[model samples]
Target: MPVLETPPLVHETVVSDRREPFSDIVIIGLYAPKIAREARPGQFVMAVTPSGERVATALGIYEAAGDRISLMLVVVGPRTRELALLERGDRLVLAGPLGNGFQLQALGKNVALIAGGVGLASLLLPAQRLLADGARVHLYYGARTAGALVDAELFEAAGAGVSLATDDGSRGHHGYVTELLAREGRTHETIAACGPSPMLRAVGTLARTLGVRAQVSLEETFACGVGACWGCVVPLERSSAQAPAFPPVAPGETRDYVHARICKEGPVFWSDELRW
Candidate 1:
């Protein structure tokens, strides 16, 4: 019941430099080593670009190199667009390994991992853990084109079956991953996903209806990673009768805020835990 001390937002003694698609984006190092040590799949980082206090971005760690990490970010928001202009040596501020992460134990060998666009950033960690644990991972990844594809080969190299889908039919399947998922994913024992909310909700709805064990990482708007304000709360269904209701009418344990942090409670929640 006590407020979880969000491992105080600190400036890591040293920040590393990282390179990506657009921004040579100085890695600015890593934090939450404890959380990173145990960070489940579907967790993320809420970071601020030093340029402007209002410039904030939520980026998913694609690879963790102990003290160094990797992320995929697109130039969308003003903060990111500014972040896009950052060179390799810029300093960035971040808070957390925030959010409740995924659980691999609850998953089985017949696991189907689906991702839309850059949301694949959040799933990489979990996929690696799952494959290392000997689970049969089938990745259904969708993007706009060949250049957008990421980690498909990594998943394949890990011995998991991989499938690709692009809107332009420039890659693997010629349609949305959702369309393929509606058909092929039923064979899997579990489903895990991250991406746009609409896409996630569609999958979550299907998973719930089919009684398939499912987990989804959310992409919600957030302010503080520690849930101080109502900024990041998400709607979710009752996972159990005792489970709290989401979007609480009043403040109490009765509300279960899904993906509150995308960094802290989740970037992942049970499919049933999310409100469609």
Candidate 2:
């Protein structure tokens, strides 16, 4: 496949901002018009601090609408704390609507979306898009506790059925959310998920068992938001349009695959295409 030109990165001033605390996580909403207009479901942006105090961190472009975008983040480090501290009227230097986002249009009419903890950020936009298209969406969300399963009503408002689970048994199901998906999710034609690797793995496994297509968004700590660093890579079974070219390794087969840069090639991959 031919390489396409990358979109120019832009800096959008934060027209508005706020922090919503849910358990230990924080969801920051930044009003960035360009990003809101360009961003697609499941894509991310590198949010740089105003002072340039540290390297920018990758964050999901959670919600986007006319001139506003939101990011949901877990305040786990100093970098995240910096973003969490921003109040209304502060500025946020954003890099892009980077990486491949979910291909919602191709997911058919019945879809199940699974989210784990902060991973919910990556799927909200997808759910909204799917709902807007008149698709039947079921959101299977899980967190460490009931309080951690934040903003589920947002999905409900978008016309998606919401199901919940938590590790501490403080919510709907008394176990991992994957279990909820496995038991109640067989009806969907596609499964879309974003979360910790283990949860993603389980969702992938379940999708395969049910003979349903799945797209999983991986969670990685990226050293660079761009593909040059090769720090965030995941094994894939086939080359994608976004992957680099490789020489064939055998007569009838192309190279088995290569480690694709998650930051550039994808944070989301077809479950069957991934070697992991």
Q: What TM-score fits each model?
A: 0.81, 0.92
Distance (Å) between predicted and true CA of 129, model 1?
A: 0.6
TM-score of candidate 2 versus the correct structure, residues matched by position = 0.92
Collision count of model 2: 0
lDDT of 1 by residue, 151-189 (tens): 577778768788889989988888878777777537889
Candidate 2 pairs with clashing backbones: none
Candidate 2: list runs displaced more than 4 Å: 1-7, 239-243, 249-255
Q: Per-residue lDDT of 80-127 in model 2, one digit per residue for the tens?
A: 888888878888888898998998877889999999999999999999
